[model samples]
Every structure is written in C-alpha cells, then in structure tokens.
Target: MFCERSSGDVQKEDKSSSVAVILCFFGEQQQGGVSDEAEPFMGSGRFGKSPTSPLHHVKVVSSPFHVALKVNFLCQLFIRLWPDGRNLQLHFRSRLSLPLFTGGKVEGEQGAAIHIVLLDVNTGHVVTSGPESTIKLDVVVLEGDFNNEDDEGWTEEEFESHVVKEREGKRPLLTGDLQVTLKEGVGTLGELTFTDNSSWIRSRKFRLGLKVASGFCEGIRVGEAKTEAFTIKDHRGELYKKHYPPALNDDVWRLEKIGKDGSFHKRLNKSGIFTVEDFVRLVVRDSQKLRTILSSGMSNKMWDALIEHAKTCAMSGKLYVYYADDTRNVGVVFNSIYELSGLITGEQYLLSDSLSDSQKVQKWLIYTKNWFDFDH
Candidate 1:
C-alpha cells in the first residue's frame, strides 16, 4: 500500500483524446444495492461503490506525484451490492499512458509491470490487507490506437465496454501468468505485481484489467475489476539513464561501429553510412520508394531485414545529447505508424478539430523534416 504522501493529489499534463474516454469507462450507473445483511468483505473495512457505504467506501487512487512524460498507471476498484444483495459489483477504473524515455533505451526490454491495488471503494482508504483466497486475480493487458481517430470515435457505449468485450476481434498485446496473484501479501494492504516481457509493447498503448475466479470469494462474488487505459511516465533523467544496458545496445547502435565480420557492415561502410544516424536517414529516405530501396542489389528478405534493423537502431540507439542555450530542441516525437503496423483501427471515431486538417498535415511535415535535421 502507498503512504499518505503518495496518496495526495498531483497535477498531470493534459491529454486531449483520452481524458474523456476515461470518464466513460467507470460508468455513471447509480450505486446499486447488495443484500444478505451486508458485512465487511475484507478483514474489517467498508467497501466502495455503495452510497450507504460507511466512510470507508471510496475509490482508491494513486499518489498524486507523476511526471509529464509517460501515461500514469492508476486504477479504481468499485465494490457495489447488486439488487439481489447476494453479489457485489466488480467494476474496474483503469488508466492508460505511454512512457517512452527520450533518447533512452527500450520500454519493454525490462518488461512492463503493474501493481493491482485492491480498495474498499465505499471507504476513501486503500486496502492495506489482503483477504485469504485459493483462486487468485487475473491480469490482462489490452491496447488500442487512440491516435487513429474518426468522426464519431469517443462514443460512451463502445469506450465503456472496451475491457469487458468478449468478442474475437480483441487484440491483447500481452497476458501475464494465468491466475495472477493480486494479493502479494505485501502487508496490511493487498497489492500484487504482474509483468510482461513482450517486444511489441514499445509501439502500442496499454491498459490493465483484473479477474477474480470463482470459489475464491467463498461463494460471495465471482467478477473482475479493471483500470482505465493508462501507461506510466518516468522523468527524462530517470528514463534517460535506462538505455545503457549492453543487451539492447548492440551493433545496431551505429553503422560505423558494427562488427567487421559481416558483409552488410562492410557494404554500409563502403557507402559512407557510418553512424547509426546516417543509416537511419538512408533507410527512411530510401523507403519512400520500394523500388529505390530494392535497387541496391538487395533480395526481398534482405530488404525487409534492413528496414527492421533500421527500426531497431532508431529504437535502441542513444543520441549524443548536451545542454544548449537557445537552439530549439524537440524532446519526444510522437507519431502513429499504426496503419503500417496494423494496430487498432477505428473508422467511426471522431477527430479533434483544434487545427484544420491541412494545417495539421503541414505541421507534421515541418516537424518530421526538423527531426531529420536534428538527428543528422
């Protein structure tokens, strides 16, 4: 369980598209009732999701302090009594954020982890203790491409049901161990950690969801709770230092520094594509035309590998950074390659009108061009 210092409120950078999507997920439904002579579900605390819930019934939130870079990992669990008064509502309030370190190493290399926080929603307090159970909590990570928006994108029904949808089209980026142990027995508070070492997490968005199997509730409730879609952010300095690991920082880091044993390295050097930065420009600029890239006597398999290698280099290579006085520098460059990568697609989603479509396109071209200059 986090302390009161961590529990206090912290202001966060504003995100346009997702801010509203979160509100639609928790659901605005009235606090339904629970029957069978309600008693504390935990050792002795009151549960949230109850209007008549004792002072203990309130949503559990994260410590207010967070960085402006990555998405914040926060969740709210609601326990409500159903009209039958026999079952409780296992509702989840999930948050989503993408924490990419500027000029740092891979985001998922160490693996993505989430702490499942259980709370007495009726009470403002966090559940410090774990209840005994044979069956454990299950954690699932789901993702979508919010950057790919449409005219009617943020509808309430579709956004709210994203987690619970049992349809086959669902794209789950990664699934932790079967039967996640939500109650890690950390202490008075019940907290559990689930982690995934998936390679694709770098480019996609993430959300955390939970399920409590049957009989664990001792015939009380069999349901789940989920956090709204959110990713966590590490400060620039904190994140910048994570990139020096040897495994991820290999030959792809620089064309000039590649091992001399390979013919590919020799060819690149002959062409004067020495540093990783130079090679990235060649791949990206040449890739604008498939024929141009393939014209270098490259086989189909070799061409694909080349682009993939370039992508790895772009993702893993560390840039030489120095403190500057007045020259403008862009820290993070956000782009949606979802279409090329076949990530989540939304045909009916709404697009933000803060800028005209043409104006947005113009700004994108200028930004990409500027990025190329800075890297070169």
Candidate 2:
C-alpha cells in the first residue's frame, strides 16, 4: 500500500486553498486451495493457476474540512478482478461544491480544484467520480481552441462548447474531495497460517482508509504526487534500527557513496576537474570523457559498485545532486550525469530539471532512444 500528496496550494475559490492525495495498493490475496498442478486448469487455461477474488468491503469517507463547506458526495464502482470472479468494489466520497459566480461567467476563476480517480491496475479499468460533472477522467481539461472558420468541420469553439455541455453533469467539481477506505481478508476458502512451534495464529489482517484533500484549478495540467507506504506489525522481540555496511558487491551502497563525500569531486578537482559546472561543460563538449572514466576497467569491484549505485539512485528518486558556493546561493549548481542522460535520452529517470537544460536535448533523447521520465 502507498499514499501520496501533491505540492502547491490548490485553488478552488479566490480565498480557498486545496491539495491532492493519492493512495495505491498492491492487491495480493489467495483464494481457492488449488494445487499447483490443478490450478492451471481451474479457470479455463487463460490465467493458468491464478486465483480471482474481489477486494471486498471497500469503504470511503469524506473529510470534515469538505463537510464544513456543505459539499458532500460519494460514488462507487464494481470492477471485475477476473473473467468470472467477484467484483472488486471501489468507493469515493467527498464534501465540496463547485463555486458559482453571481451570473454564469467562468472567467477570472483562480481557486484550486481537486479530483480523485481510481484505476484497477490488473485490468486497467478506471472509475472516476468528482464534482466536475462534465469532465471526463480520461480528458479533464481542454488544451487549446480550434479554429472553426478555417477548418472544414465544426469549429474548435463549437466543438469544445459541445464537449463542455455534454460533460457538465459529470464534472468532478460537482462531487467534491473523496475519502477512500479498503478492507481485505480471507474468504470462505479458509485462512492459511504458518506457525513457529505450536500456536495457530491467524494471518495478519487489517484495512486501510485514506482521505485526500486537494485544490482544484482550471486547465488540467499534469502535476506530481507524492506517496508513502508503511506496515503495522505485532512482534515479540524488541525491534531496533540497524545500519549495516553494504557487501563488497552491493551496488546500492556504491552509488549512494559516489561523489557524496566529495571524493569524486575532490579527485576531479585535484586533476583539474573543478566544479560541477565545469563537468557539465566537459560532458556537453565530449560525453565520452565521463563515460570513459566511469566505464574504465579500473577495478571490477569499483565498476560494479558504480553501476549498482546508479541503478539504486535511479530507483530511489535520488539521482539529482546539487552544489552551491555558499548558503546564499539559491539555485542548484549540479546534477547527476545519470539523471541528465536519462532526461536527454527521453527514458524515465528518477529526477529531471527544466530550467538549466534545453528542451531540444530532451526532445531529441525522447525521440531517439529510451530515456527515463523522472516524473513518470
């Protein structure tokens, strides 16, 4: 399970603020006690031995903040987890309302707007319920206007106006902020338990519910969301935080430590490779220089370490590095080469920067090879 929140103030009305929250779960559950061999034949041959069961008893609640505004709403959807399996239910509840101008003008709207959507990863079935009744979850905001006079078909304004009218009833603003809760447990097949010596203990069971508050705004541009995951356990022994040095070959340790202690920077500086700015210039001048240094067969152990570090940094969203001359320096001076390469290549990386880099490089990499999109 995971939870995330977006940054920046959500604008609903000129005076109101808002934010968005997202929660996700890795649905893992066991149902029928089919053996490994017979399992493959249980539900036709399509899924092989995979068991299908609904994520039952899903519940959602709205936040008091929204309720205070007299904006209350709820929506529920039943999605099939398997071809013939029970339906996994999802519920969304919110208590916010769409602001109305004295007349019907939508201009000068500056408040935040919030929207929530649920997607079934297994089947890619998405169910969205919000206050903006006319907005489709797939395409919430209109990007630009179309010129009707020049075009042969319907004009852009007419088309958009039609779309707006068609979707006015389904807009998210009509629903409000949503509160979601989920309950998962063993089914009629019976619960399975593993014991240490003699006690028969039931499997760890619990439910999760979350309330996300976000501001809503016009122009549905993409924004970043943050999330976290945690577990509650009841163990007998006293738990203690432990820090262990990475094994000689552990790539994660290698990457985190790279240039962290200024060792690499110091080495480069000693060899006349001054600041990160200089490094960036060198990379732009000759990308192979840094690659040669990193890929050179100096020590198998060190090479392995660097590779591992890079991978770890890529996964952890910590690929960006910063350098500043003093406390007063406001802008970031340096970033990880791995991150830069990912952006330049158009593949998804853990981090990306726009101000310091050129969009042409980004576009070129995205069109040419696989580069990481950190935001993705």
Candidate 3:
C-alpha cells in the first residue's frame, strides 16, 4: 500500500520489505514495488529525461490505488494517471486547434450560409487531417456584443442563459439545417435562417456559436467558435426590398416609406403612377406634380430614400428624338420615360432642317438615332 503526500514526494505504507522507486520523465517502473529504470510509456519520452524533464511532481494514492503525474509545459500541466492496477496509459491534455466560423456579415432572413473549419492557431492554417477531417457540429445562436472576449471561461449553462437573454428572454428559434457535418474539416451551414430579428437595442447584433456534436466530440476539444456581431433586419422588409439597378417594371412600393396599399402607394396609384417607369416619367415631365402627390405625408428623409431607390432603375437602351411640326424650336430627347434633353442640347437644332420635311422625317430619324448612338 502506498499513499500520496502533500509535498512533492512518494512513500509506501509498508515498512517490512525494502523498495526502490525511480521516476523518469518518460515513464515509471517498479521493482519490489519500485524500479531503478522507469518503464517507457507509449514508447516515447515526450517530457524528456530527468534534470531537464518538466516532471517536477509525482503523487501516489492507495486504497483504490492511482498515480497522478503532473508536468509544467506551456503554462499548462499534462496530466497522466494509472488507476486500479490497470495498464499504464498516457493521456495528453494539451490544447488543440479550434474550429472557426468564417463568412462576411450575414444577410438576415435571406437563407444565408456560413462556413466552419478546424484551424491551427499556432500555425494559422486550416487543419484537415486527424479527427477533425470529418466531424459533426451543432450550431446555436448567441448574444452579440456581450462582454468577455470570445466567451472565455464560459460554461454551457452560462452560454444558454446569455442566449435566452439575447432572444428577449426566450431561446432563439433557429430554423433550417443547424447540424453540419464537415468533410476535409470544412462545412457549410446552408439555408439557415433566424426566426426572429435581433433585440431592438442600440448597436444590436447577433452571433452564431458552433460546437462538436455529443457523439463526435470524443477527442476534439473545439474551443469557442463564433461569428462576429451582426445585425438582422426584420424579414418583413424583404418583400419590399429592391435589387440594385432595379428593372423598370418594379413596383412603387419597393421604394422607402412606400408600402403596398399604404397612403403613399394609394396617392401614387391615384395619380396613375403605378410602376417605377410611371414615377420616373412623371418626375421628369412634371416635378412639382410628383412632389405634390406625396408632399402631404412623406418627410424629406423618406423622400430622399425614395428617390435614391428610384435612381437605380436602368433606362431603356432605345432612344428617340421628338419635335413639333410647327417649329424646330421645341425638341426633346427621350430614352424610355427618362428625358435626356437635359443631358444633350443645341445638337438637335442642327438636324432640324432634315427633320423639317415631313417626307424625310423617317429617314432623318434613323440618321439622328445613329449619330447620337455613335457620339454618346
């Protein structure tokens, strides 16, 4: 029987038989309950031999019988133990490469996707070999902008509590595929969307956390893997959101402060301005008329947002030059509903002589069209 001491020493309870004990950085051996040469564990000396070995402390406890070996390496101790007279085995408790989440800011309610992979912090490389090659990951939503860098020293219960607070005292309802299986240490979280917008607060944002699935975390110690804080706009806006360089046929409600069947939409519709084309034409032809239509309820900021969105509409490539038969003084250039006369001037008068004759009008129109296309 042996007993571990508080000090850095080992002693046996039995005093009758003589015993010799020798402990090495590589392994330990026993002769008459002790040995002069240590038995090499795992066939290697990772902790090096004595004098240079980091193995500074060894303790043996009896009754159930176990040996606790502790070493100082990288500010952390590598602990190994032998229990219940079992075969000597080495357990490496060293830090491992962690999984990381990568992808730019997420677009909420858009079925956004993100990526995850095992990363070697020491080498700064994506690790695809070993147990990380193929592993299952479970993702959860976390509170963004929370204090405590990268959630260090946080427990599972603490994380869950924070998540509950983040989603307004309710656990976030994450929909779509959340369990991702990696191949070559890389996996994509596809078609994942949040059921609720981030909490309404100043600088409000949300984060996603990833962890190894229960059965798959056997050997991998995946440290905190989370995304940067990001905002998620209400999903309702998605239906009215307009793409850049919007098509001419896009609805008026796509503009800011304009909702379907709302006051702005009703007013615009009453004025026969239904599509973006109609709105653009009315703005070009009668600026005050368009302003007066929405001037009652819309604010300057709202008007700016509306105009900015409308400006992104692409004009028809086809151009037409129009003039009155009575006089060449009046001329207008139109590309779809957009009046381009403001962009080009004086040149129209030069082609007036050819345009004046009614019989030659069609012929000169083609010539004018070709000239404008070539020049501009």
Candidate 4:
C-alpha cells in the first residue's frame, strides 16, 4: 500500500513517492502556462543563467529524445558559426617543428645569423601550429663586382618601390638599433670609408631593401681635411724643388736702337722694328750676300750678333726680305737676317753706292725689303 505524506511529515514506512509521476507533473505544467512564465525568468538571471547555458524550460523537458534533438541543434549552430572549423582543427592537429642552428664559429670565417620570432596578430600567440606558419631565415653573404655601373643605375622610383614591395607583408624582426660596418677594402674605388654612422631600421621586413640601399653607399657625409702636405722626389732619390725663371732673363736681348737715322729709322720704329727687327731684316734681305762677305772676312762678333738677331726674329716669325741679282733673278724671302752679317753688309754697301744721291731712297728700299720682299 502506497501512502503519500501530507503537509508536515511522513513515516518512513509510508515512503513510496514515484519519480516518474513527479516528472510527468513538471512536464505537463511546463507545457502549459508555466513555460510562458519561465520564459521571462530565463532572461531574469535568477538561476545564474547565460546565453550558452541550456534554457530552464528546455532543461526541465529532459526526455531522452528531446535532449538528443537539442544537442543536434547546438552542433548545427556551432558548424554554421565556424565553417572553417575543419581546417582549423587540421592545422592545430598537424603542428610544425622547425630546425634551429645555434651560434658557432669556424676558423678564418666570418658569419652571422638572424633570429626571427613570429606571432599571431589576432591573439598575440606564437604561431607554431601549422607547417607554413614560421619565420624563415636565410643567411646569404653576397659578393660581387662593386664597380659594375649596372648596380648603380637605380631610379628614384625603383628604389622607393623596391623597399615598399619587400615590406608589403612582413613584420619587424629586430629590436635594438642596427650598426653597420662597411669594410673599406670590400667597397669599390673612391669609397669613402669602412664605417658608416649608426642608423635605425624601423622594420625588418624591409631589411633586404635596406641592405640594397646601404650596400649602394649613397649620401654619405664627407669631412674636409684642415691641412695637407705632399713631397715629390726624382729618380735619383733627391727631393726636387720647383724653380721658375724670371720673366725677362739674361738670355733675352733688349733693343737699344733700331736703325741709323731718317725715314728708315722712322719706318722701322713705326713698324715696330726694334734693333732685333733691323738686324734680322738686313740678314734675311741678303742671306747669300752676307754669307759671301762672312766667307771673305767678317768679324766673329758681327757674325754672332747677326746670327743672334736672325734667330730671334725667325723665332718671332715676323721678318721678311726681297732682292734682285745682276742677272735679274728676282727672289722673295721671309725670314730673320741676324745670322747673315756678310750678306747684310754687302747689300747695304751695294745700295749705298748705287743710290748715293738719295739716302732716303736707299733707306726706304731697305725698310721695304725687310717687310714685303720682291727680289727681281
């Protein structure tokens, strides 16, 4: 016999309450107005509920069939919320392991390694899960002909773009400031120095571009020397000093007088004919005559003076002469006559005797002979 307990207490001998009946009553009541009333209570937080928690009414409807249906609905909702769950699961399941090379030294070798750390931006977590999620470090020591102009012909646009493109999808791998050491001998000719001033590399993704730019060694600051000295030496191991002779020296002759007098003197002087000009004019006018006289009996001093004057005027390239022999053999000559004293004296004597009446005529002829010559 089953006897239900009334309001206060029940004897242990009459404890026969059925769990199924209690569940049936709760379900019937919840399906009625109790469910409607519990809807507000579900959101009221009275039961410490959350969005992810099962609904209080639904929890009460805990039949095995309904529970299975709720679980299936939850799974469908989860799949809809995260469609890439399969891929994410696969990525997490197949973790990546990278090989590391510790620092080491070899004899007669210089080397360095770049340490890289990759992180997930969304969660600030180390991205060590997938095979492709890693930082690849390549240690490449580039050596080539630095003097090749082909490397130096980068346009401004190409340079800027090179940097931008390299850094398009990379992050900084360095922390502290970077120091550059440019080996002097390793650079091209006229490279300024082996050490460059310290600079900051804001990002490491652009390091390749920075390396290219730095390798170029452009826009370096140059310092001027306060003073410099140099010494020159001859093959004899003797230090040589520069010696500059005076402008007008002992070797050069100056004109004291041009000619004897009158129109010849006036013409000579007017025509810029100094003593050198007069002497050169006479010799060049009658080279053969002067040579004959010198051969006959001329003083060395006079010959020397004539020779000197001829050389000077010839070197100057300004004297000219003309004359005619007894046979009417006309000749025109352009030269200095200082070297032919015999010829000059002979010509002068002939002219003086032939035109003794007109000194002016003889002088004029001499002067004209000195300039434009027409020997006939």
What ranges in model 3 sit over 4 Å off? 1-64, 68-113, 122-124, 144-160, 164-172, 193-206, 217-220, 227-246, 285-289, 314-334, 337-376
Per-residue CA lDDT of model 2 for 164-281, tens digit only, reads 1112343232122123222121111011111111111122211112211234213232221111111222223112211132232222212333443355544545545443334443
Whole-model lDDT per candidate: 0.36, 0.28, 0.53, 0.30
Candidate 2 weakest ten by summed lDDT: 185-194
Report the lDDT tens digits of candidate 3 across residue range 33-110.
333344332123543325423332333433332333322220122111111112211111122111111222333233
* Number of residue pairs clashing in candidate 3, backbone atoms closer than 3 angstroms, sequence gap of 3 or more or interchain: 4
Q: After superposition, how far is residue 29 of candidate 3 from its true place, in Å?
A: 11
lDDT of 1 by residue, 1-376 (tens): 1111122221221222122223322333234322223322321433322443222233333333431111232231112122223322233432222343222222222443334444444563344444532236655544433323542223323434544322255333332243555443211112222233223354344455455544465534433454443442333334232123222223432322234445556666566655554555555445555335235556677566555554553243233221111343312223221111111112221232454566455444544455545532
Against the true structure, candidate 3 reaches a TM-score of 0.53
Can you rank all candidates by TM-score, best first?
Answer: 3, 1, 2, 4
Work out the TM-score per prediction.
0.27, 0.20, 0.53, 0.15
Candidate 4 per-residue lDDT over residues 1-376, each given as its tens digit: 1111222221111112222112223333333333333344434453223542233222244366765654454344334334333221001111111111111111111122322233333454444544323212221111112212443233434434433221234332222223322231111111111111111223211111123223231221111101011111222321121112211111112322212453334554554444554434445556565445334344566556546544533344434434444542332333333221112334343323343445445445545555443442
Supply the global lDDT for candidate 1: 0.36
Quote the RMSD, in angstroms, for model 1: 23.4
lDDT for residue 299 in candidate 3, whole number 0-100: 86
Q: How big is the RMSD of model 3?
A: 12.5
Prediction 2 global C-alpha lDDT: 0.28
Candidate 4 clashes: the total is: 15
Q: Who is ahead in lDDT, 3 or 4?
A: 3
